[model samples]
Target: MSKVSLPRHVHRVVSRGREYFYYQERRGTLHAGERIRLPNDPQTPEFWNAVRQAQGTFGPTPTDTIGALIDAFEVSWATRQRKISKGTQEHYRRYLKPARKAWGDLPARELRPRHVDALIRKIGADKPGAANNILDALKAMVSWANGPVELLTHDPTQGVERFSKGEGHRPWTSQQLAFAEQVFTGTIRRFFFLSRYTGQRISDVVRLSPNDVDDGGFSLPQKKTGVKPWCPIFPELEAEMVTWERRPGPYLLQSSGKSAGKPFSTNQMWKAFDRERKKYSVLSGAVPHGLRANAVIRLRGEGYTALQISDMVGMSVEMVESYSRHADRKASGQAVLREFQERDASQIVKRLESGKRK
Candidate 1:
């Protein structure tokens, strides 16, 4: 069998021509734990659970420490008590690492807003986005710690500010979209249309299957938010679908590679989309995620309210409003222009009436 990548602290040994995996703490480490046998298949969830168990037994951690709180929160996530999508869990883990490294041993009650602020500033000096993510992760962990169990006395992340950043994922312009219609074809074109019409995140879009569609429309339980919204089959999307050859699995599949015919992973889809996007100067600023905002803007232009857009797209009304900012501004400007025009026209009519009276 081919070699498999193993998680940290895990080791593989070949004994009597049989492969076995074990989780062994480093011999020289201060808190060396006993060697525990792990499952043969690392891909299974059981294997991960075993790994978690092994890590848990490594040493005693103070219940009040930040590290203990972090571990508890992670367990909650893994056990689905504080349910979050896998993608979100991964994102949180990435940011939580710095906190775990820096302040894991510190008492949770002792963490202050100043410490949080200082960390943010230190990280913000280099990567503002990462700093903001770290702050978000810290806020979430601190909030959970202060819940019914009350691991913390006060919120350390309270009054801590996120680093200011540009409005993320700029929406594609009509001109750029029009340019895409001429240049883009096949899977890339289909991806553009699905993202442009559904207003779903790329994560959900890649997982979209023919099985999800019904008479009403596509019944999608959104991955990130878990909102099961029925996205209507717009005529534009339907037109594109009619041309597509039916497939057994997902609507979108990898056309070529060792993974060909399998559904595209989110990263793979983004890279493929990006490669196509880079071919034209007009599309340089455009991205796959921007198509979601593009869809929201189009819906707003068609007179859909924020609540209506929220229902259709499974996004919070606040997010719908955020994405529709440009559309809202345009609508507001038009309303103001119409008011001025109507006032001018009314005055003109009054003047004509006065001339007639004279």
Candidate 2:
């Protein structure tokens, strides 16, 4: 078994042969007491985003104190208007709790990069990843307080050194896709298909509603990017989606058992998805979110441009290119072969003419 490094304040426990991870402060619970279960096995991009988004470093000495500024920022448009996800808000609260105890009474205007640097070192000693996460939250807070009536004139987190966060999750392979599709059944199989075709994270995928479907396409904002793009339902996917019998609820994916037919929370959704995923003898690094990579690669192979892929998947061109490199390599090789074939045909004809002349 490989060693796993969790974020600051996060602990892991294995119960009944399953692993669960979460953040806990000495006093208060993180995320308003909502348990955030970190992804198991191969940590994907979505899992890293959830980890980096949740850790942060608090409350009220004065209106101009750092704590006060964080309070104000939390209620600002970014949080209130859903610019960030629910997991992000919980992270803000979790980190701020400790911050309040440390510097809640300090004036925000007096803060300097050196002060933030010291705090980062203290946290990084335990978990460098969470140190960066906390730094990100402070940076956001200070930026939010840049108005005429704001608390600070300069952002203290500007020059703070960020600990290195490694390259995130790996992409899924064609073999892994085939194995998963073969093993997964019923709702799990539907989820596998939906994610592959739609290029959506499981978080957003679980919340999909029957009403979100239409003649145009599937309409929904991406949870990570906050961009809403219409995805055309291809014949293969449309047939499956159209035939799905949604429970008597708004969510397209519903839970089984005592909570049968109810919508799945973020934790519940991933846990259930993982439960089914673990049963398969698939690739070690395979993850559900890698379906996004599958979609991008498949589309590129079918001659879809990067911009078209971006629009369909609600990702930037850079992201699409990263996942479609395999397809690009194949296309390049095919182009080279075509050129060789054309040149060889002309040379063959010339040789035949020369032989006839002789």
Candidate 3:
């Protein structure tokens, strides 16, 4: 085969009587030893476009800046591979946006622990949880850069401590549930019942289908965890869905209107739920997500072990225990109060006997 002279950073090789072009980055870590095949003839627009994509130059050049690293990471995951959920990808973008404005142009290799410390302090002042989440996002990107992308030899966000936030999502009380139930009816009521009974997230609940139900139980793979939760359909949940007059279309919680029977989009459903919730005088600090905590707490109170709750809820044992912490504390306090009551009763009995003898 005759050697074809190619452009710098572009290599040509022939196999099976066809010519192929591959573009490699001359300087970038990800570029080193990586060959990205071009689509067609070198002179065509498609070929250059393919080369640009392979080089990852369609967006900001991911060469040196921390901002570019974030861009590259977004391109790789959000646009190209899409390995994470849309919500998670949006979260990453939200966290990275301010970071990009602050330090995007800074060299990733030059970032030090002190820089991370300063960033954390600055972000933590306004919102501690957000600061922690920012660090987590940066840490994840840095790790990806160091490993797969090969853009960095070292992680910049290493050893950055997460801000101490209290336990997440306060458990919903029975009174709160009752008030919300009284306020919500039909579709919203059914949705709330599904969430509480199944201990699933709102995202999963909105996506539930009739096919997700079975003869004995409700079974479906959770969106965030990918764990298939097979929960025995609670009697209340069964009755709630069975009695509904409107036929369910795509989702179990089908909305009525022009799109009748179709499932509610996550945002549309959440916004609607929120608007109605604000209308009613619901419990403070209670959210739809807290319903999951309520379920976990109720199950724990009913003598279900942490492990059992974890299995039913498709959560880790640690998470189940965490959600049950308030319930556990209440139980413990009651037990201690019982001990004092018993002691006081015995003292009363002794007093009564002495008085009778006198």
Q: Each candidate: what lDDT? A: 0.82, 0.70, 0.75
How many Å off is the CA of 165 in candidate 1?
6.4
Best by TM-score: 1
TM-score per candidate, in order?
Answer: 0.79, 0.66, 0.75
Residue 181 displacement in candidate 3 (angstroms): 2.6
Candidate 3 wrong stretches, greater than 4 Å: 1-62, 74-87, 245-259, 354-358
Candidate 2 lDDT over residue span 1-358, tens digit each: 3444445666677889877767554426443544556556323333443454455321112346665666556545342333666556677777666566778768777888888899899999988878888887777667767765455788787778998754334567778877876776677777777888888888778867766776757888766557777777777787776677755544444556788767777688777878776776675667777888888888888889999999888888988888887668878999999999999998888988889632
lDDT of 1 at 81: 51
Could you give candidate 3's per-residue lDDT for residues 150-232 as a string of tens digits?
Answer: 88898667677888867888767778888867777877787788888888888788887777876767788877656777777
lDDT of 2 at 162: 90
Q: Rank order by lDDT, top first?
A: 1, 3, 2
Q: Report how far residue 219 has shifted in candidate 3, in Å.
A: 2.3
Where does model 1 exceed 4 Å of error? 1-64, 80-82, 125-129, 163-166, 342-358
Position 310, candidate 1: lDDT? 86
